[model samples]
Target: MHVGVDVGGTKVLAVELTGAGADVAVARSAQVPMPGRTAADAEVEAAVARAVADVADGRPLAGVGVSAAGLVDREGRRVRFAAHLPWRDAPVRDRLAERIGVPVVLDNDANCAARAELDAGALRGVDFALLITVGTGIGGAVVVDGHVVRGANGMAGEFGHVQVVPDGLPCECGLRGCWEQYCSGRALERVTRVALGSHLDGPEVAALARAGDPVALEAFATVGTWLGVGAAGLVSALDPERVVIGGGVSAVGDLLLEPARRALGGALQGTSHRDLPTLVPTRFGPEAGAVGAALLAAAGD
Candidate 1:
């Protein structure tokens, strides 16, 4: 069996997979709390290792793949930094390998999810695809020529940090008016709270949208506009065959997508010409990261 681990800001998720190619089976899965942002590197690695152990179930492992929410080096062995989690230049692969006694591969969480989509989910036969992960912030990945574009610094797909407003909301990356600040889960929460004067979280807002709450619907429309605005830039630059929106906020679906579609049409450079890419939802859901990580590890072998 091959193991995949997704280490997030608040939790660690691990999955065990058996089989090959598109026929892979999910054997088991586990989740654990991640270390605090102030946590030491050892603490973070230990939490990830514990999650892997919980899911392995004593099966002979091929290798462990880790999907991390942060910048990773070109080699995909080190996590350069993670804003929400405490990791900086951390040798995650080597340390985790030492603990598990197997090979470990690490990559940006969005890259893993994108790989999952390309190999077994949304972008299956597409030659060029863009995946935008909408969560606390946006993370992105591109599949070009059947391979994830890692870029020169392995930071090519940071779609969130792309500036949208010159002097807009402050971002976690110390920038002002980043695309994620206005388009992600955090943006949803902020807009809901400020506009409705209610303290509803993301899921609560989603529920409200389902219930047809006018305020919630409007908030989604606003955020969706920003999402589309940024997406237009990506579409212009990459021109992927499709764009898949994943991560937690994707649950809101067309509440955001309809607006995104409208805005994307307006924002595109040449609105009247060119075939726009298909913008769709992800089929893999939250487990995409872990599943894709394991797939990547298995492929390397």
Candidate 2:
């Protein structure tokens, strides 16, 4: 058996795998709340260890894979930085491996999500695509020639940090007007708060939208529009055949995607002359990261 851990901004999700390759299946899963933004590195690590042990349930493990939301080094041994997590130039993989008494591999959370899609989800059998995960923040990955493109420094797809708005909202990364500030789960909460004068997380806001709350509907429209606008720029540059949307925020489906499709149509240049990439949702939903990480561990990569 193997275990995969997805350490996100708000929680630590872990899954145990029962097979290898296309036969791989999630045997068990667990989650734990992550430490607050100001948490120490040891606190965050302990949370991850707890999740892994919970999912493992004392069963022996072959290896472990970690899908981290940050700029993981190419060697998968260190996390160069994480805007939402406590790690900064930290040797996370080795530390976790030591604690779990098993080999551990690490990669960017978005990269792991994309790997899952490419293996058996939306991007399967496709050559050239883009994946954008709208969670607590935005995470992106570029797939070209049937593989993810990890650019120099293995941080090619940090799309959230892209400056979409000039001197816009302040970001946790010590930047202003980042794309994530406008088009992520956090973005949804921020917009909803403005409309209803109430604070709600992504899932709560999504629940309100599903219940036909006008404030929630308006929030989705606003964030969805921004999502499309950012995608338009990426489409123009990469021209992938498809763009896959994953992560917690994508659970709303068309409520978010339809508006993004509309905005992409309007914002993309030469739309009438060029074939615009089709936008679709992930097959694995929010668990893609955990599932993909498990696959990586199964493959011993």
Candidate 3:
């Protein structure tokens, strides 16, 4: 058996795999509360270890794969930096390997999601594909042939940071005009709050927009436009054959994709000629990360 762990800001999901790639077994999840004032790195690591132990039981795990939210290094064993977590240049793989008594592999959460999609979700059977996730932030991954493009510094496909507007909305990455600032779940909330003077979760906001809420509808349109613009930029840069979108906001479906499709057509270079890549919603949805992690672990074995 192989263990896969998708470690998110709010929770940790663990899955067992019986075969390679998409052939995943039943999954078990555990909530990981964000550490408070007194939390330390060891504490966080301990939480992860405990979660892995509970899920693994006594099955002999060939390896453990972690899909983490951060800039994982090229080595696939260390976390270079994580915006939400306390880890910076942490040897996550080694720590987990030592505690679990098995090999551990680490990957960026978005990359893992993309891999999962490619293996068994929307991008399956495609030689080249891109996975763009729109959630609290925008994340992208490119797969060429059958392998993921990790870039030279393991920071490629950061489509969120691409500058869309000059000196526009401020981003958490200490930049202005980032694509994420205008296209993410948080962006939707900000727009709705500013226009409606209220906050709504992603699905509720989309429902309101569908129900003739002008402010909510307009907010989605704006975000969709930015999403398409960013996707177009990614297409220009990577030229993938297909693009798959996933995340909470994507649950809004056509409310968001129609505008994105229009914007992509308008913004793409050579819009008048040449074939355009297909843009579709992810098949695996929220479980892509966990499934991908399981696939990675299985492959390592």
Candidate 4:
């Protein structure tokens, strides 16, 4: 059995697969709360290990793959840093392998989601594709020839850090005017909070937007415009054939995408000649990270 784990900010999600094929189905699935922000690094690692053990259920494991919510080495062995979790330059892959008794691999959560889309979800048949996952921040991946473009320092897919504004809002990455600060889930929450003196959570914001509340509609449009602006820049740079808008915020559907499509056309490098890039929603939705992580573990590379 192959196991995949998604190490998220607040929860660890794990899935087990047996006899994988087109007919593959999850044999077991589990979710455990991760160590809180104040927890130590060792405690965070232990939580992940416990989640993996529960999913494995003492069966002979084929391999274990983890999609971690932080920057990781290209070899998928080390986690450089995670803002939500208390890990910094740690050998997470090695620890998980030691505790689970299986060959373990690790990758960025965004990369894992994009890999799942590349293999079985969006960008399936496309030669060139760019994935932008808008969660707490933006997570990006560039795909060419079925392989992720891991930069020299394993930081190639951090599209959120790209500067879109010269002197804009400050970001967690110690930068100003980052694309993610304007386009991600946190951005939406921030926008919503600003719209009303009181605060509304992510679900409440989405609910209001879906119900056609004017304030919610305007907020989504504001973020969608920024999403398109960033996509336009990416289109000019990479010229990918397809672009995928995903992560938790994608549930807004056309509310987010339609404005993006409209804004992207005029911002293209050569508006008249180049074909407008195709933008689509993720096929795997929220499950992409776990599914892709599992596949990577099964591949054992």
Candidate 5:
């Protein structure tokens, strides 16, 4: 069996797979507390090692694959940097391999999620598609001809950092006008707070918008427009055949997509000449990451 680990800021999910990623044997998970004094890297590594040990249970393992959140290096081994987690020029793959006593492969979480979508989720059968995840922050993965495009620095599809508005809202990445500041789940909450003078979660805001609340509707529209603008930049750069928008906020359905579609049409460089890629919500929902990690693990065998 092969072990796949999806290490997030708060939790680590581990799964055991067989039969070329089709059959599942056992699954387990563990949480890593926020590091108090020590670096979060050690805590996360410990959590992943524990999770893998629990799932392994003495069975000879094929290999290990890790789906991490960060800007992975060109070799897909080191994590150059991550905004939420504390990893700087970290040799994650080598460290994990040394600790677990097995060969380990690592990739960006967005890329892993996109690979899973291509193998078993929404983008199945599509040759070229862009997986745009709108969660606490925005992330993107570019798949061309069934292979991920890890750019020179392995951060090519980092659409979240794209500047949508010059001198706009401040981002945690130390940027002033990042796309995630306007087009992510946190962005939705920020807009709702500004427009309604109250904090509302993504689901609540969507419900209010569906009930015809003007403020909620306007917030969604604003986010949708920003999403389109950012997506327009991606389309211009990659020219992907399809754009898959996934993450927590995508549950708003057409409430967000309609405005994004309109904005994408309006912002395209040559609107009439090029075929606009279909913009749709993700079919995998929240499970894309785990499923993708499992697929990566299976592929390692």
Candidate 6:
């Protein structure tokens, strides 16, 4: 079985994939909380190894794929940087391979998600598209001519760090007013806290929003609005045929997307002349990253 791991901001998720081609499916999965950002790179890699082992459950050998939430080098050998994690020019792929005792492939988590969508989920036959994942922070991938673009520095889709606000909010990447500061899980939590005058995590805020809490509902609106505004800029630049939204925050569905759609329609450039790109939630949701990673490993990508 091929094991794929998604190393996110708060957890390490592992999925065991079985079968081939269109028959591929996740047979089992496991997760472990991510070590704190202050932890050493070895500790974080160990957490990923543990999750992979838990999901494999002592099964026979197969290659492993890692969907890392960072700037994975174009060669997929090193994690150049990760704002929320401790990896900094770390040789993560080699280290994880050594620990797991298997051939390993690594890539940016958002790129992995885009690969999954292109392979089997949403972007199957599409020629160009943009994928934005709204988890702890934003992650993104660009598709052009049916291929994901890696850019000159292998960091083309690091859109989360885009300065949307002028010195607005501080980011872990040491930037101010990044798009993620206004449109991610962390942003949702911050907005909800400000509205309700207390702290609450992403899931808690979603729960309250589902139950029609005014503060929670408003928080989604706020974040969703920012999401659209930022996406408008990207659409203007890339002009992708479709814009897919994924990640943990997208699980709330229309509670978040509806607001985003409205804002995109209003804020987008050339509204009267250009055809607006469709903004939809991810078909595979939060699992897209891991699924894509497995596909990469299976195909030796």
Q: Which one is best on lDDT?
A: 2
The lowest-lDDT stretch of 10 consecutive residues in candidate 1 is 17-26
**lDDT tens string, model 3, 162-210?**
8889999888899999999999999999988888787888778988987
Residue-wise C-alpha lDDT for candidate 6, range 1-301, written one tens digit per residue: 7888998878898898766655666788899999977899999999988988898787775899999988989899999988778999999999999998999999999999999888877788888899999988888999999999998878988889899999799987788999999999999998877777899999999999999998899999999999999998999899998999998898999999899989988987678999888888887788888989888887887
Model 1, residue 257: what's the lDDT? 87
- 1-301 per-residue lDDT for model 1 (tens digits): 6789988888999998766656665778999898789988889888888888888767677789999999999998789999988888988889899988989988999999988888778888888989999988899998888788999999989999999899988987898989999998889999999997878889999999989999999989999998888999999898888999999998878998899989988998776778888889987778889988988888873
lDDT of 4 by residue, 229-283 (tens): 9999988888889999888888888998988898888688677877888989987
Candidate 2 deviant stretches above 4 angstroms: 18-24
Q: How good is model 5 by TM-score?
A: 0.87
Candidate 5: tens digits of C-alpha lDDT, residues 1-301: 6677877665677776444332333355434443432466777788788878877787887778888878889887799888777878999999998988888889888888888778766787888889898888998899889788899889978889888789998998898999999998888999899877888998888899999999888888999998888888888888888899887787888889889999999999877888999998876566566557767767772
**Best TM-score among the predictions, by candidate number:** 1
Better of 1 and 6 by TM-score: 1
TM-score of each: 0.96, 0.92, 0.92, 0.94, 0.87, 0.93
For all candidates in order, the CA lDDT equals 0.88, 0.89, 0.81, 0.84, 0.80, 0.89
Q: Which regions of candidate 6 deviate over 4 angstroms?
A: 19-23
lDDT ranking, best first: 2, 6, 1, 4, 3, 5
Pairs clashing within candidate 2: none
Off by over 4 Å in 5: 17-39, 54-60, 207-214
Off by over 4 Å in 1: 18-20, 23-25
By lDDT, the better pick of 1 and 3 is: 1
**How many pairs of residues collide in model 1?**
0
Backbone collision count in every prediction? 0, 0, 0, 0, 0, 0
Error at 48, model 3, angstroms: 1.6
List of clashing residue pairs for candidate 5:
none
Candidate 4 regions off by >4 Å? 18-27
Which is the better candidate, 2 or 4, if ranked by lDDT? 2
